[model samples]
Target: MFRAREYKICIIGDSGVGKSCLITYFLTQKFDSNNKVTVGGAYHEKQLFINNEPLHLQIWDTAGQERFRSMTPMYYRNADLIILAYSINSQKSFSNLPGWLLDVQKYHDGDPILSVVGNKSDLEKYRKVETKEGKEYAQSIDATFFEVSAKSGTGISEMFGKIAYQVAETRDRAKQNKTGYINPESQTETNKKGCC
Candidate 1:
């Protein structure tokens, strides 16, 4: 039995960290050597099958500049998953992730699943954010971390897979809650009342 699920995800990080490049690479599989800095944000959609079930994902790639920060909360509110991207070559980008996470926590209702991506792995020579530090910070915030190179298409598929898995899990939990099996007391109360 194959069911289709829809997921909404957002990519947020500091400016010039290749957030747009990552999206372009994942969806189009083509990298722009002269990719322009995203002004506000960009959107992309991709579909995949998980356990033979079709899953459609809508991804929002947000700008990382301070001027654009105020508009981020609106997008974060509706996201099922959030990806905080940073460049391995830029320490400032990595350092700014905590503030971004804080924004998500403050504006979003529930605790959303997050993934931290240290992009530009192809430029290992200029790497600034240590893998151990990145992973540790991700762990501190309960986020999954991966080092990826949008240029080489490294780890993009796995990143999306993680997002899909989280979405599937969330959907399954929601389904259980809707069926009332997850909350027996609520189910009992509802069943006691007349059909309405």
Candidate 2:
């Protein structure tokens, strides 16, 4: 028998950074070069194992256009993990990350478990966001960073795997504390009964 754990992840970034493409590649293991801009939001699900435990991940892909920004906070509120996407070829997209981060902070209380993805890595010839710069920015905010090409299936698995591990770890810690508290209380009750 297998028990499946469910997790919710949200993707955010500027338009044209290929946020939808990354989710497609990870879930379907295939990429569409002609993918269109996401209108409001889309969701995809995939089942995988993290440390031998079954995990069902529901990924929410949000529209990166300016018009959709107002509706984004509702999506962020329930996210267990977040992926901040950027395109290396577009300087504007890269520069807009700070604003995106701020939105996440404001809506999500600045959760620490975030992955910073520099997408469209296949176009490295036209890259403007240097690898060091992306890494530095991620470090400053305590996020894991990766350079990925959703079109080429680069770093897609690794990024999701890291997020899964972080989620699992957080869940495990919570479970341990719950168990520890209950066990001690039961033991105290047994000792009191014996004394009476």
TM-scores, all models, native as reference: 0.87, 0.87
> What stretches of model 1 exceed 4 Å from their correct place?
1-3, 177-196
lDDT of each: 0.83, 0.83
Deviation in Å, model 2, residue 139 alpha carbon: 0.5
- Candidate 2 versus the native: TM-score? 0.87
Give the C-alpha miss distance for residue 172 in model 1, angstroms. 1.2
Q: How many backbone clashes does candidate 1 have?
A: 0
Per-residue error at 88 for model 1, in Å?
A: 0.6
Q: Which residue pairs of candidate 2 clash?
A: none
Query: Taking the tens digit of each residue's C-alpha lDDT, what string does model 2 give over 24-77?
Result: 998888998888888788888888776555788888999999998898888877
RMSD of 1: 7.9
Q: Please estimate how well model 2 matches the true structure, expressed as its whole-model Cα lDDT.
A: 0.83
Q: How many clashes show up in model 2? A: 0
